[model samples]
Target: MNTSASDPVTDAPTKAAPIIEAQGIDKLYESFQALYDIDLQVMDGEFVALVGPSGCGKTSLLKILAGFEQPSRGSLEIQGKSVVGLPPSQRPTRMVFQKLALFPHKTVRDNIAFPLKLAQVSRAEQDARVAEMMDLMHLPSAYATRYPAQLSGGEQQRVALARSMVSRPSVLLLDEPLSALDVKLKKVLQTEIKHLHRTIGTSFVHVTHDLEEAMMLADRICVMRHGRILQNGSPTDIYYRPADAFIAGFIGETNLIPVQMDGAAFDNPALRCADPTLDEAQFSPGHAGTSGLLMIRPELIVMRTEAPDAAEVDCVMEGSVEEFFIKGSSIQYRIAVEGLREPMIVDVQGTATPPATVAQKVWLSFQRRDLYLLGEG
Candidate 1:
């Protein structure tokens, strides 16, 4: 799996210094600890996403970065300077909240120019900067005189992003800014935000619970749970090489078959590995015990009417289709394999010939190269 965070332009390892350095950070609400020893770094011009369920300390960490809430412990530096005690206004980062916090009464131009105005920039400079930002955001000059209530949700989002970028901060923090938009508009703005980031080359630290959104937009994804960072790596690493089963299930639809590994072979009676000489590198590191999970992506498992040849595939299982869902571009099946409590999921392309039906016996096969071993923890 590719673990390195690559630069968006060159697709190579990023050599830029971290624009935001947060080490051993912790946040507490009196006796209740909201965050643990959280250490994160946002590389210059990199986009990182903080993703987890609610109450996972993602928002707390963002608040600490924005200086809205002080950390109970640890150090934070932006551009190599400490910003722990600084106010939000004094910090060099701009945040676009979930609600967008756009001034409803103000015109688009005034809303985008608010940051510049607060910085005491000259009016002429503010106008020029606002105009540049509007052009960059693809907002026409005619819309500049309109209020937020008059503009569409997507347009309001663009205005919020423009306001955040008007000051040209080294890092732009987004707190689920697209959560409220509809699916279609959210996708549109997601593309626009990605393009804007590429165009401006500003570091972005976006916090969201949407895994798909994170995978789509972030260069590196940080998975958090119980106020701690569970995993941090490139999207490929997180998807194909998840650290644990929780992350595996969180990323997408998958099948995690419990297996006992005895040396280089699985001892589970329900599983059959055609290849006896499977490499140990296929297993996750630190899996000391004889137990682990065999992770197979839904799309990787092929449903066959006849048993596949042992030489053709590494693993094979016999199961009957318990249920199925037609997902437009793909067909998802729940296969009931004996000795397993949950049904195994398999996804076939919508274009594939002859979809499987419920109660039909099918052979599920996947190659060793496509299988990933995850620690049972």
Candidate 2:
């Protein structure tokens, strides 16, 4: 893998100082190890999301980096200065909690102006800045006087966002900022947030368990599990080239097929595909007794009622359709292949494509290059 400077998508082009860096971060609660040697860096003006299931330590790591929680071990630096002893309020980073944490007593303008007030900006300057922030967030100036309880959920979200951005913090930590909104509102907010980030260019470290949201918003994603980062990369890299079975399964829908390698070709009882593109003689002699899994995405599998006209690999699999799900953009077919414990999933696009109903026999095939090889669990 050419993971060098030439690969600008994954590799850093220059040694610019990371806006925030956490190294060897270890946190423990009595006997329970919360975080283990966690290492992460956020480039200046980058939008990064920490994503995982519940209790993945994403929130804990964010707190530690924001100076809200002290680490048991390791160091955190901002612009090359160690900030171990700094208090959360003193840190250049600010956090927007899931609750929005707005003061119900204060009006939208007052809430946004609170940060400027603490910073001791002049009264005239504070008013001017508040107006500018409200405009930037697309919040109406008339809504400034309304309290949190008076505004709609979406409006209140804008208020909270305006408050956070008003300070112009070097870094912003968002903890599931859009989780409270309805699906439609969440989507609108997602686009708004993306546009806001582009305009501000401030470093954003967003934490969420929503995979699609993370994929859409993050310049890079940090996938965490059991308090450790399992993988970190752009959405395409993480989705198409998952490092292990856990990552492969977590990122998206996949069909994990057990396989054994004979020379350079993958041999499987279920997979009858042939690849003329790969050199069969150059296969690596994998570790003995170590099983392998072939990861194939649902979309990569082609379903045909009959035979294909193209001279493709005849890796045909005959299975009875167990279920068919009508996803808005695509249809998902679950096939119960004989001798397999799990049903094979295949995604077909377009409404014009013939639907494969339950109990119908179908053939599936795909190219070898599209199949990812990984160590079996």
Candidate 3:
């Protein structure tokens, strides 16, 4: 089908020097390979996220970069210097963990100043840096003497961030720092982290299993699968133009309908109700095949009681609304078809004119570009 990935932000196509670069990276545990030929680059001042399910090697890759673990084979460089064998403290990077790892007995000022102490900075410098970090994190200086246990979760997070940044590392490593918080707190921290990244002007390598968090925090995302990078791109690229079937399913709720491909054109009895205005012959013969999925996002599906204006839309399909759900700002309709085992989910604005009701016939319309052709796995 016609390629239709939304370009949310057009960043530089290349950089003079990457902040961190890993080449032919591999990690093995006893004979089990955890990562294979992992090559990636983090540009200066960019936020890159490593995302995948459990045991997907995202954590391993992060550890390798942070010097907590060494790659079995590869070259790693930070700020144009090779850091393959350097310790975490020696490398130009810092890590923030999920548990915060803040000393419960230590006050906020002491916690943030811990890094300065390790570097043997003068006490005057330490106090000055600590105050600056607290100010940057928006933590009141009055709370400087309070212990981490006395602060709220968000406050404690700010302290953890302050500790990590006080060292002035060029690269900051975050291992699911926000995953432990509740949804609301997580969202607040997400914005705070992004703002902090911008203000600090440092490259950030964040690791998380939460896809939405990565989408919110990362300028670029590396999707891993079974110890391999599956796709790497902007959020728009990953969501709208997924590289393959697995990414399409993993990134969001999608409806995969089986369709028959006739040469470069899609042909199936199910497509008969589609509007003629759609660019039907969008696919090429080289990638033509019957064992493929017509991938459509639920939000893109428009349900109506009457046929949509053919000229104003693309394709339209006939189905019956079998189930209905009221989301906060959107309504979900489960439309049933003759051959499909499960219903197709169609999402529409909650305030749409004459919404669909359960057990009612409805039409689903969407653009031709919205029709993503993915090979069935």
Task: Please report the candidate that would top TM-score against the real structure.
Answer: 1
Provide the lDDT at 118 for model 2: 89
Give Cα-based local distance difference scores for all models. Answer: 0.90, 0.84, 0.84
Model 3, position 232: C-alpha lDDT score: 90
Which of 1 and 2 is ahead in lDDT? Answer: 1
What is the Å distance of residue 68 in model 1 from its true position? Answer: 0.5
Tens-digit lDDT track of model 2 for 316-357 = 667889998888789999999886788999999958655778
TM-score result, candidate 1: 0.93
Q: What is the lDDT of residue 214 in candidate 1?
A: 95
* CA displacement after TM-score superposition, residue 140 of candidate 1 (Å): 1.6
TM for every model, in the order presented, reads 0.93, 0.91, 0.90
- The list of candidate 2 runs beyond 4 A from truth reads 1-14, 276-290, 313-315, 350-354
Worst 10 residues of 3 by lDDT: 276-285
Per-residue CA lDDT of model 3 for 253-275, tens digit only, reads 78877777654456546655343
Between candidates 1 and 2, name the one with more favorable TM-score.
Answer: 1
Which residue pairs of candidate 3 clash?
none
Model 1 stretches astray by more than 4 angstroms: 1-15, 276-278, 352-354
